[model samples]
Target: MTIRVPVVERILSANDQLAVANRAQLDAAGVFSVNLMASPGAGKTSLITGTIQALQGELRIGAADGDLASSLDADRVAALGVPAVQINTGGTCHLDAAMFQGALSCLPLGQLDLLIVENVGNLVCPAAFQLGTHRSVLIASVPEGDDKPYKYPPMYRGVDALVLNKIDVLDAFDFDVDYFQRGVQALNPDLAFFPLSCKSGAGIEAWLEWLRAEVRAYKERRDVPGNSGTDH
Candidate 1:
C-alpha cells in the first residue's frame, strides 16, 4: 500500500520551465543576477556585507536574503542603505525561480546593476534549483573542510565561481589548499576560484574587480543599439 513517485526527470523539467521565465524577467530589466549558496556558518552574510560595502559608490547593488525563519541578514543589509529584500521560506529548504520572482517584485529592478540572492544555507538542496541567476557562486569555508567539493559534487558542479573563505584560519585547520583546488577542478575545471578572508578583508580586491567587470559587461550587452552613448 505504498504510493510510488515519478522519476527525477519530471521534477527537473518542471523546475527548468520556471527558470526560463525567471531569466526572461531579469533579462528585460538588464540586471545581472547571482545566486549564492553555502553551508551554515560559512560566512555567506559576512561575504555579502563585505561585497556591498566594497562595491558602494561603484555599482548599484541589490540583495535578497533567504532564510527559513529569520530576517536578521535582510535587516543588516537594509541598514547598509541598499535595496534589500527578505524572503522567508517557512519550512522550505531552498529557493526556486518562483520565490525569487516574488521577492524581486518589491525591489527596484531598474535601479540595480547587480542582484545577489543569498540562498538558504544548505549545500545539497539549494544547488538543485535555478532562480534565473546569470551565475551561481558557491562558498565553502575552511571550517567546512576542503573535501566539500568531492562530497557535495552536485553543488560544486552547478556553480560558476567558488569562494574558499576563511583563508586566515587555514593554518589553524588541517585543510590543504592544493588538494581542495584539485578536488574542485575535477568537477568544474574552469570554474573561477577565489580564496578570501572576510574577517581580515584579505584577497578581496580581485573578486571585487571581477564583479565590476561582470556588471559592466552585462550593462554593455543590454544597452540599446542606438543609445550606445548613454552611461549611468
Candidate 2:
C-alpha cells in the first residue's frame, strides 16, 4: 500500500498538467465543457439525449463518451444531430486528461458552444482525475438510495453540480429527497442542485435555464482581464 501511494500521486500530477493544457485549448476556442459522472444506469446518456433534444436549435453541442467498451453511448448522442466522440477506456474505470485531450482534437472545438464529456460509469475513480471541463456534474437517481452521498463522499465533494435523475419515480420508490440533499449539503454546501427526470422531463426546463445562464456568464467572463473565477 505504501509503495503504491507515490505512483498514484505521480500519475495524478501528470494528469493535472495535461488537464491544464486541455483547459487552455478550450479557453482559446471559447468553448464551455462539462464532465458528467455517474454510476452505471444512472441515466447519463438519457440526460445527454434529453439536453441535446431540447437545446438543439439554440446551442451547438458536442459529446465525448468514455466507456470500458462499446460505442452505444456515442451513437445515441450522435443520432440527435450533435457531433459525438467515443473514447474507449479499454477496461479502465475512468477517463484521464490525456484521453479527453485526444477527443478534443477530434472535435471541432471552435464550432461548438457546449461540450459535455460523459465520464465512465463509476462514482469513485472519475472524481480523482481532472478532465479540464468548465464544470463537473454528477447524476444520482431516485433508485440509487439517498445514502450514496454518505458512502461516496469524495464524488459528492468534488463535483460542481449535482443532478438527481429518474425523479419521476420518486413516489414509487422509498427515497427521501431531503435526506439526499442534506447529505450533499454537508459535503458541498454551495453545490448547485438540479432535481429532474430525463424520462418525464420534470424540472428539466430549470436545468436548461441554469445551463444557458452558465454559458452566458462564462462568455462574459472572457472579456474581463485576469478573471479569477473557477468555472468548475
Candidate 3:
C-alpha cells in the first residue's frame, strides 16, 4: 500500500497571514521598515549602528537585532539611545515574520519614524524570508570575494539595495571593484549598490542620503490624504 504525504500549504498560509498583519501594524504606525541581511562579520551591526547615529536627530529610529545566541548587537544599538529589541533565534538560522511581530511589539513603533531589522547573520536563509519589510539591504564585504552574487543568487535577487562593505581592505586583498559590480548587475540589473568602508567612514554619505530620502518618501506617502492606502 502507498502512503500519502499531506501537502503543507496550510503551514505557509498561516505564515503569510501573520505577515499581512505585521505589515498592517507597521503601516498604521507610519514606520519605514528595512531588513538588513548579510553574512557573519560582514559589518551588518556596524552599518546599523552607524545609520542609527546618523539619523538619531533626523528621525525617530528603532531596531530589532537578531542573532542565534547573544544580544550583543542589540546592546550596541540600545547604547545609542534608540529603542532596540533583541530576538534570539535559539538554534534557528533565520527570522520569520512571526518573530518580527514579537520584536515590533517591544519597540515604540508608533513613535518610530524608521524601523531597521538586523536580520540573522546568514546570507541565504535570511533572504528567503520576507519579514514584511519595505526594503531589504544585503551587505557583502570585500573579504567575502566578488563571486558572492553568483554563489548566493537568492540573497542578491531579493535585495532592494546592496552595500559593499570593507572597501578599505581592497589593497590588502585581491578584490576587484569592477568585477564585483558586473557580477551583481548580472544578477540584478537595477540593484542600487554602494561601496563603503564602515570602519573609516568612507562612502557612507551616499547611503545615509539615500535612506533619508526613502524615509521621507515613505512618510509623505503614508501621511497624505487621498493617497493610496499603503501597507509598507
Candidate 4:
C-alpha cells in the first residue's frame, strides 16, 4: 500500500525554507531586493528600465529577469550597463524560490545596492512563491482595467506595494482609478500605491522616490531592524 503525502505542502515548505536562507544571504550581502510581478504587457520591463536610468547614480543595481522564453527583457535592461541575469522559466508559470536561488548565485550581491527580480509575467503563480526579496511590487496597467484587484485578490493581498502603470492612457481607457484603488485598499489597507506612466513619465518621480526610500530603509533595517525592519 502507498501512503498519501501532501505534495503541495511539501513543495511550499521546501520553498519557504529556502526563501529564509535566500533572505538571509541578501541581508548578509547588504543587498535590498524587490520582486516585480505583473501580467504580460503591463510594462514591467519599461518600469525597470526607467528605474535603472533614474537611480543608476545613487544605486548600484542588478536584475534577474524571468520570461517563458528568450532573453528579450533581460537584454533590454542589460543594455543600460548593469549586471542582468536572464531566467527562462521554460513554460513554467512563475519563478519559484529554487529558480531564484540559481539566479542569485550568478549575481554579485555584495557589490550591488539593489536587485530587481522580474518574475514571469503572471498575476497568479508568482504570488504563491516567495523569492526571498526585501519586498514585492505588483504592476497593474490602466489598459488592464480596474477589476484586477477584485478578480486577483491573492495577487493584491500578497504584494507589499502596488503600481498602476500607464496613467497617460487613462484618458483613452475606461479605467476607474478610484475604483481600482478602492478594491486594492479593501484587500491591502496600508498598501503603497503609485499611479504612474512609463510612456510619458508623468508620475515616475513619485515611484522612484518610493524605491529610493525602500532601499534606504532596507539598509537601515539590516543594520538595525525596526518593527517593520524585517521585510527590508
Candidate 5:
C-alpha cells in the first residue's frame, strides 16, 4: 500500500501537468470547455443533444464523447450538425487530460465557441481527473435515487454543477429531491443545480441559460490580460 501511494501520486502529478497544457490550448483557441460526467444510463447523451439543440445557432458547439467502447455518443452529437470526436478508453473507467488532448487534436477548436467533453459514465473515477475544462458537471437521474449524493460524496463535491435528469419520471420514481439537495449542500454549498428532463424538455431553458452565462464568463475571463486560463 505504501509503495502504491507514491505511484498514484506520480500519475496524478503528470496528469495535472498535462491538464494545464490542455487548458492553455483551450484558452489560446478562445473556446469554453465543460467536463460532463455521470453514471451509465444517466441521460448524458440526451442532455448533450438537448444542449446542442438549444445553443445551435447562438454558439458553435463541439463534443468529445469518452466511452469504454463504441462511438454511438459521438454519432449522436454529429447527427445534430455538431463536430464530435470519440475517445474509446478501451475499458478505462475515466477520461484524463491525456485522452482529452488527443480528442482536441481531432476537433476544429478554432471554429468552436463551446466544447463539451462527455466523460465515461462513472460516478467516481471521472471526478478524480481534471480534463482542463472550465466547468465540471454531473448528471444524476431520478431512477438513480436521491441518495447518490450521500453515497458519492467525492463526485458531488468535485463538480461545479449538477443536472438532475429524467425529472419527468419523478412521479414514477422514489427520488427525494430535498434529501438530495441537503446532501449536496453539505458537500458544496454553492454548487449550481439544474433539475430537468431531457426526454420531455421540461426545465431545460434554465440549464441552457446557465450554460450561456458560463460561456460568456469564460470568454470575458479569457479576454483579460494575464489570465492563464486555469480552472477558476
Candidate 6:
C-alpha cells in the first residue's frame, strides 16, 4: 500500500514556507509587521485607525486590510492618509501567507517603519494561518462576552498580545475582566494585555507606546550583525 499524507498537512507546510519567505522580505526592508485578528465588530479597523492616528508623524505605517469582500476597511485606513491595500479573500475566512505576499508588494515597504495587516474578521480561521509578522495580536471586545477566551482557546493561545477592546461599554455589559484574564493566562501566561476602548480613545496612549517600543526593538535587533534575518 502507498503511504498518503493529508492534504491539510501539505497545505499548511506550503503556507509555512511562504511565511518564511515573507518574513525574510520584511526583515530585509527593516519593517516590523503585525497581524491583527478579531471577529466581526471586534474593532480591528478601529484599532488600526486609532494606531495610525496616534503614531502619525512618528512612524511611516502601512496596512493591509483583509476581508471577504469590499474595500471599506482599506478606505478607512487610506482616509487617515496612511498607505493601505485591501485584500478581498473571495469568501475565504482567513488570509494566508500567499495573500500577504501579494499585498506586501503593493505597500511601500522601503519607506514604512511598521506594517499592520488587519486580517479577516474571523477569530478561528485567522489564528490558524501565519502571515510572517513580528507579532500576532487578537482583539477581544467586551460586548463579545468574557467567555471568549475559554471558547476560543486556539486563538487565545496563539497570539502574542491581546487587545481587550470596547472596555468603555463594560458598565452596560456583564463582562468579568478577572474571569477573562484568568482564562487567557491559562493559555498564555505572559501574553501582553491592552484593555482599551477604540470608540472613546481610552487607554490608546498605552497601546501606542507599546507599538512604538516593539517597533524600535525590532529595528534594534535587526541592526545587530548576523541577526538581520531572524524573526523573534
TM-score (all chains, Cα) for each model: 0.92, 0.96, 0.93, 0.94, 0.97, 0.96
Off by over 4 Å in 6: 1-5
Candidate 4 wrong stretches, greater than 4 Å = 1-5, 225-229
Better of 4 and 5 by TM-score: 5
| Model 3 whole-model lDDT (C-alpha atoms) | 0.87
lDDT per residue for candidate 3 within 156-226, as digits (tens), equals 98888999999999988899889888888888999888899889999999999989988888877876896
Kindly indicate the candidate among 4 and 5 with the higher lDDT: 5
Candidate 1 lDDT tens digits, 144-203: 887888899999998889898999999889899999999999999998889999999999
The CA lDDT of each predicted structure is 0.86, 0.92, 0.87, 0.91, 0.92, 0.92
Off by over 4 Å in 2: 225-232
Q: Give residue 203's error in model 2 in angstroms.
A: 0.6
Model 2, range 30-64, lDDT digits (tens) per residue? 88899999999999999999999999999999999
Best first by TM-score, ranked = 5, 6, 2, 4, 3, 1
Q: Could you give the C-alpha RMSD of every candidate to the true structure, in order shown?
A: 3.6, 1.5, 2.5, 2.6, 1.0, 1.9
Error of 5 at 213 (Å): 0.4
Q: Write the per-residue lDDT of candidate 4 for residues 112-143, one digit (tens) a residue.
A: 99999999999899999988898999999998
Candidates 2 and 3, the one with greater lDDT: 2
2 or 5, greater by TM-score:
5
* Residue 43 CA displacement from its true place in model 2, Å: 0.8
Count of steric clashes across candidates, in order: 0, 0, 0, 0, 0, 0
Q: What is the RMSD, in Å, between candidate 3 and the native fold over all Cα?
A: 2.5
lDDT of 1 at 202: 92
Give, for candidate 2, the lowest lDDT window spanning 10 residues.
223-232
